[model samples]
Target chain A: MVPINEMKSKCRFAIILGVTLAIGNFFRVPYAFSEPIVFIANDSVPMDSITRKELKDIYTGKTKLWGNGDKIVLTFLKQTDVYAYFLRNYVNKTPTQFVNYWRNMVFMGKATFIPKSIKEEDKLMEYISSTKGAIGYISSNKLIKGIKVIAVK
Target chain B: MKKNRMIINVVFSILFIYSAEVDAYSSDTVINGFITQGYMKTDENNFLTDTEEGSFEFNEMGIKFSSAISNNLSIGIQFFARDIGDLGNDDITVDWAFADYLFYNWAGIRIGKIKIPHGFYNESRDNGIARTFIFLPQSVYSDPWRDSLLTIKGAGFYGYLYGLSYQLQIGIMDAQTDGGLAKKFNDITKSSIESIQPETAIIFSLQSTDLIDGLKIGGSVSKWDWKMDLTIQDMPAKSDDEALLWAISIEYAKNAFLFSAEYSIFDVETPIDLYVSPTAAPYRLPYATNNVMEGYYGSISYRMTDWFEIGVYHSIFYSNKKDRSGKDNVKYYNWKDYYSWSKDTCLTFRFDLNQNWIFKLEGHYNDGFYNGYITDNIDKDGNEDVEQYWYLFAAKLMYAF
Candidate 1:
């Protein structure tokens, strides 16, 4: 048999441990809380900022060409967490819904290109850096060299 | 065997050309396709097929490929096959093949076979998995007009101006008389149409998507000229006509709810010449008249969850808007089986079994005898045996990628 004070102390410790674990789990995935950062090819793209609506239009294939008559190449991170977060906030759609929209567009002969999806952050960055007219998004903390961070108005 | 050989040859030729083009621009090439199969049955009348005894002869399959040739030019092609009872007969044909060139963010041009820009859903009508219902509102999207309005061989100009998207097309079309529209004319005239030749066509559409976050309001107008040749008991006659079709549509989709409405009218002016057999009469008959068809539908859908959705719609169609009641048709034609309109109420449910598979079920309550496009509903004596009221059920399974 334990004393009453010791039992109370043990119970308090267990509660604190559970809370700590929950908080840690919630923040363990950077996508859950971090805002997505928009990026473009530093050398090819001349635009520095884009409106949220313009971004949405570009992602949805509504805006196919940029101002300089260059095609807008789109790239996407395939990680489910970050992709879901970006779709929900930027496009006002779920990941599945966004995919379905593209599929319908492609099948109906409305759009010719589907965004390139890359699983690794490094690979996405590399592709954007190497390709002209390329644009993509990453987590806030994953910003790398050779890519321009554009502000979403 | 001949059809199979032709299909194989076409497939191989497309593959060879596509591969060579891909090798030239290997960076951005994508391929996708879908398959759908459906079953339908009606209690009394055949709707689109032999549905009175239940039928599974409705299926659709398509394959599409697209590639970017340059920064501002891209090309795409799609091959489609379908069997809607006796309509498609499992014929594989070119759905659309176009080369798109973008001059500016606001303007572009597409050359080749292009999809017709009609109502909101007309362009994507073949994509079953993307829609909430297995069958769209039939009043506006009549089955008989599907083949005639699917695509046009010509050029189109598309652009965005002040937040409004517009598409204009000018093309040539060859009309086929085996479709539903021709059948309806035959039923009315008691004649068999041998051929139809389409002279020219033009279509224009304008849609605004920026008024609200998820709202779209649009209108479309299409006009065409056609010449038809008919045979009535060994007597031949020719007729020429001009048809004008126009529609207004509005749709709003936000969150888990979607609402849409559309109204359309088809006006036709034709000169008809009628003649009886030599044994019956040698005198000419006068049966020329102008015709107008009008239809409208309103629908609402709610997504209960990520995987489930339900929708309902009420649609109404009139063979002649001026004569909303059948009294004029019955009196003028001296026919007792004439019906001037159809009113249909439909309920649909959809389940997304997974990301790539979808299942849908639909039920319809119909009133009137306007649904005679399906040949099975007509009697062997060339008479129509149709009930004034009926029920129909349909189910479809689709796999898309």
Candidate 2:
């Protein structure tokens, strides 16, 4: 009989391999963590390239309290791998850690929230079209009139 | 405490306005909104006392607006109104009003009266287009028939990366099922399900479609606690009430096949000791008041050479919560017999009228008792047990923009 522990370890390895292969077969990573869609507040904040690191820092609360003294407004597409990529590429934290971190920070009275954290590309477009200080992103294919797209670092 | 909360909310609102101005400078104005209406009639289903039928009625209307103040900063606000139909008066309420700042898509914060994102549905529960039916799977999503008063007032961060979303919130808020008004719309203060309490809750969800087109799966877990003052049976006490909820759901649709299901479990802790009796033998004071709720429904619609398509669905709900000691019960391991369970099953047939409208006829069967231990003794005539059964028929017309 195959050693139980070794067999179990082999089974686990096979499962991991299968899952990884299956995932690899199904989804492809986006060109960057930043969504294809972008937004602008005023002329002072140039409509230009954003470094992935700076983007991550801003989102993760490492860089709280904007120079303008306003709390950062964060928006997100509801649960999607794009969010995972953004978290991994920029925030350098797992989604669970990120959520826990923010919850802890908010409890300490150190942060505020963004009004709309939408998943649908259309809704993200709508946010980009109306709000002033609102910065959001969506799929490139979903792009339409009113919203702007900035470059990623 | 009340005055302090009011002041805090006021202060946050002011801060939001200031940020809004800054956001206006660089952010483009974005406007978004949706409208949904549902019509249905039910005869002797769930907890409704009477059977009634109704035509199409406007169920929800809402608008959300946001703007990016700068490349790294933004703000957003949302306003919505709902019509609960016969469950109560035709009332309108602001569903969610908040401001957010995203330093990046990876991280941001939200403040104001927030949707206490505790499950997969908390934030999107009001969006009608997100679900196929007029009503959601009750036991798994909205248990104890209470949700309107469950939202919170506070601030937290919301972030998404790769394929996950997260939310954490803290505040002094009202509890559901307590029969008090904790939320306000303009000047109208509606009665809430529970009295006010300080609360802390967290939500984390993960989803992926990159693995397969038109298929998504995710899970969420939440825990919250509330402070309560209750007087049951003329006994008064100050207590802490807590509940933990967990759920997992999956969705897949391609061509004509669509399937979705969600399962949720909740454990509630009350504040009372045990009292022994036959029908009311308190199972476990300071024990485990546990309830498991779940629902799954799958449907298929074939193009069938255009013009028309037909679909059928089945859904089930079950709740097992035995309340023995009223408000002062703890989940002690002793009293296990006090728990009871109830089940509701439904079947639906729907017909499509083009891309924007559909008509459905549905029926529900319910086993009225909370626990299987209770015999169906409704008839009392001794010939047969009167089990609860009902049907709902509805026609809906929707326009998507």
Fnat for each model: 0.37, 0.00
Kindly list the per-residue Cα lDDT of model 2 for residues B288-316, writing each as its tens digit: 23433343333332222222333333333
Instruction: Residues B47-163, candidate 1: write the lDDT tens digits.
Output: 778889899988887878888788778899998877776677667788899998878877899999999887988888888766788878878887767877878899999987666
> Per-residue CA lDDT of candidate 1, range A1-153, in tens?
875643553454445435534543443322254555555554577688888778878888888777777778888888877887788677766565677788788888888745778898888888888887888888777847767778887
CA-based DockQ, model 1 = 0.16
- Work out the iRMS of candidate 2: 14.6
Evaluated with TM-score, which candidate comes out highest?
Answer: 1
- Candidate 1 is graded, for docking, as incorrect
Model 1 chain B: ten consecutive residues of lowest lDDT: B18-27
Two-chain DockQ for each candidate model: 0.16, 0.04
Question: Model 2: which docking level applies?
Answer: incorrect
Across all candidates, the chain A TM-score values are 0.74, 0.60
Best lDDT among the predictions, by candidate number: 1
Taken over the whole model, the C-alpha lDDT of each candidate is 0.76, 0.45
